[model samples]
Target: MFREVPVLPVVVPVAAAVFLILLWYLHSRDRLSAPRAAVALALCVYAAGVVANTVFPIFLDKPARSALWKVYLVPFANYEVGDAVTNILVFVPIGVLVPLLVAKAPWWRVVAVAAAFSLVIELTQLVTRNLLGGGHVADVNDLIFNTAGGALGFGLCSALSRVPAAAALIDRFRWR
Candidate 1:
């Protein structure tokens, strides 16, 4: 039951953000476009939702981790397939969106941002579990996987942007 957290809770907000961004692109003419703002807004909201869902309970009175804490440094040492994949999948959009929204930014900067984001999540898990006593265990593997996910996302989006058709489509939105 614990592992069955609904994916919709996370995906719905992001999907909505994407839709709004498309709309904003269609109607706006300011230098600051919708896609860029949407990416920032979506990233913040998504990060918050992730931390809240993973560590804190939805209801005010619900129980949390509470005295149970663990950490895994060894990659795949105690792997749970679903959790690992889900972690990577969740961050992939950030990877893709960051580069797309900040097209002029260097690749290293995009990667650094992604890594920093993952690092924050891991640290949050550690701090909340130890100090507040309710959060998932912090794991280095998550950092690795999440970083890789971000990189992959950047790669995929970047490649797509190079394609003539994709480039034309993306250019219409004026993401840069």
Candidate 2:
């Protein structure tokens, strides 16, 4: 049975508020240009979407199962290739955005951050699944694939930066 969980209804407004605050603070500091503002907005929207997808549908009624094996440890042991691909794709924007936001974001740093983010998502899922309601069980494969996605995104960003013309364009959007 599916229970409606009102996640976005709360998430969207909070994200918008944070975005507005960030825009205001940046503008006040004379750092908010059109490009930076666009990036900030996009980041906020993406973050909200991530939270919605990763941590919601928390059915307050009850959990579907009480099994202790929610944390899936084996990689590619029971998942399709498509699931792996999708996980990678989901994190690509993070890989691209971090370097744009930070002046000297290395590929390794991007991968590390992505892995940490994935870990947080999994932990949240594990906790909520056990306590408050519906959440995806933790999975080691997700962590591995999400980090790979971050690396791929950083590689794409690096390639674009190598192009003189594209580099010039991207420079305008660079935060630092």
Candidate 3:
């Protein structure tokens, strides 16, 4: 049950302010340009969307459930295609953008960062479920599929980077 409360009315404005401030800071410091700012904004929006989707809609009433949080440690157990695909797609942008944004990001580093990001999200869900009524559970399959998606995106980025025209276009938007 991944139900989220209708709190975006407040969250969106706050997130927008934060994103604007960050973009301003980076631009003032000569670390960002118009195109780079656009890229940064896209990354910020994607990250916010992921967090919102995974961690919101808490169960404040604490319905007679045994525990406030739950985890599925069994990998690939009763895996659903929709869930797996969603998890993978959610992480694919991280894989593509990290390498594009960082000057020295290798494929392994991309994968590692994706896994760490997924771990942080899962841990947050665990804590938030207990403290704030979040209903999402940590699942090993999610972690696995998220990493796989990142890997796939990295491969796609790598291949695209090898193409002269594609590389030129990517370099145009690349921050580093």
Q: Candidate 3: global Cα-lDDT?
A: 0.81
In model 3, which regions exceed 4 Å deviation? Answer: 1-6, 59-69
Give per-residue CA lDDT, model 1, range 128-171, as digits (tens).
56655544777887888787778778788778889999978666
Clashes by residue pair, model 3: 4-57, 58-133, 58-134, 59-133
List per-prediction Cα lDDT, in the order shown: 0.68, 0.87, 0.81
Which segments of candidate 1 are over 4 A away from where they belong?
Answer: 1-29, 33-41, 58-69, 172-175
Q: For model 3, how does the per-residue alpha-carbon lDDT over 1-176 read when each residue is reduced to its tens digit?
A: 54445657645776788779868877787777776777778877887788778877665555434553578899889999999998888888988989867887999999999999999989888777766667777888889999988998898899999999999988876766
Query: Model 2, poorest ten-residue lDDT window?
Result: 60-69
Give me the displacement of residue 7 in model 1, in angstroms. 16
**Per-residue lDDT value at 79 in model 3:** 91
Model 3 Cα displacement at 134 (Å)?
A: 1.7
Instruction: Quote model 3's TM-score.
Output: 0.86
- TM-score to true structure, per model: 0.68, 0.92, 0.86
Candidates by lDDT, descending order:
2, 3, 1
Question: How good is model 2 by TM-score?
Answer: 0.92
lDDT of 3 at 46: 83
Which consecutive 10 residues in model 3 have the weakest lDDT in total? 60-69
